[model samples]
Target: MKKVILTALMSCIFQFSNAQNDIRIGGMLAYGTEVENIGIGVNAEFPIIEKLTVSPSFIYYLPKKVSGVSINWFEFNGNANYYFLDEGNINVYGQAGLNYTNVRLSYDGAYSGFLSSAASDGRLGLNLGGGANFQMGGNILPFAELKYVIIDEGQLVLAAGVKFNL
Candidate 1:
């Protein structure tokens, strides 16, 4: 099931990129309020029309140790952005999307070999947010975004990154 989902996501990414000549790819530095930790993400943007785009991103939160347990978290988001303001050096947009959040655990010390459904959680959610992009001198564009994912407990995420136009 997981394989099928991943395959379809990848296929969509490729097809989107192929259809758009101005696709952009980038790495993001992200912060998740639920995890209370910093993370890294990779994202791609495919412009569909003059004022709209499709963006897909994956974020991996760094593991945190809590009482001999290591918790790992990640998220996959498929979003759409509408650029209502795309003038001059700045582009501002609103975004809405779907989110998938997953968490796993690693036990250490006395907690070794312990496994339970409680140690892992995966959920599908919804995302709503807005962002702005700053066009630099050339192909590099810097951007910042804030989003809320309505999932099991809900989370607020902040991300900033630079995208290179392809």
Candidate 2:
């Protein structure tokens, strides 16, 4: 079941790649409250129409200690962003999205206890921030954004990365 879904998703992504013009791929470093640790992510932006873009991103949070267990967390997000300022080489946008979060817990002690446990949850969030695209006469744009996520809890994320246009 998972393989089928993954294959279908890959197929759709390839099709979208072939049909899009303003596609950007980038990586980011993130930190938040619930995450409890620094995270890393990669994202791709596909322009659906003028001033509108759909971005899919994946983030993996570093393992952190909670109680007596080590927890690993990650999330997948799909966001729809609308650009209100798309003039020249700089663009500013507001984003809203849905996220699927997963967490894995494990205990490290003399006695192996609860060897495996995982939990997954989904949430809808909004990113109320804008970023500047600095086009240095190339296909790469350096951008920085500060966004707050409103979900089960509020989290502030600051991300800086270079986007490759394809």
Candidate 3:
């Protein structure tokens, strides 16, 4: 599954890079509501057509301690954004996409004297969101977005950052 997704993303990036001049790449800070933790991520957007763009991002959530277990999580998202309003310096858009989340947990032997365990789980989900980007200059834009992932472990995520036009 990882290989397949990587291949598809690389292919799209190559095609988009060759076909467009408005590609943007950036890093972001994110907050995940369900996990109750902060995450750091990076993303890229490729213009697909007028008023449409393909955006993909990956987030690595900071580890958290819950009760006695240490928990860690991360996610990958691929979304399509449709710009409904673009007023020179500001662009507002709606987005829908796919999500993949993975979580890992570790337990220490403090429970007993020899009861240590580690486990991980992965889920596939769908994402729905909206966002806006403010063009700062000829080659910089600041953006913010909010999205909800629909899955067994649904979570709302908010992200913001600056992007550089490449």
Best by TM-score: 3
**TM-score (all chains, Cα) for each model:** 0.82, 0.73, 0.86
- Give one digit per residue, the lDDT tens place, for model 3 in 1-166: 9999999898978876665878889999999998999999999998996678999999999998887799999999999999999899899999999999999999898766879899999999999999999987788889999999998868999999988898
Ten residues in sequence with the least summed lDDT for candidate 3: 12-21
Which pairs clash in the backbone of model 1?
none
Model 2: lDDT of residue 159: 72
Give the Cα lDDT of each candidate: 0.90, 0.76, 0.92
Query: Which ranges of candidate 3 are over 4 A from the true structure?
Result: 1-19, 110-114
Instruction: Give a tens-digit lDDT track for model 2, residues 11-46.
Output: 877866665867889988877676768898898888
Worst 10 residues of 2 by lDDT: 113-122
Q: TM-score for model 2?
A: 0.73
Residue 27 C-alpha lDDT in model 2: 86
| Residue lDDT tens for model 1, 108-158 | 554456553336879999999999999887889899999999998899999
Q: Which order, best to worst by lDDT?
A: 3, 1, 2
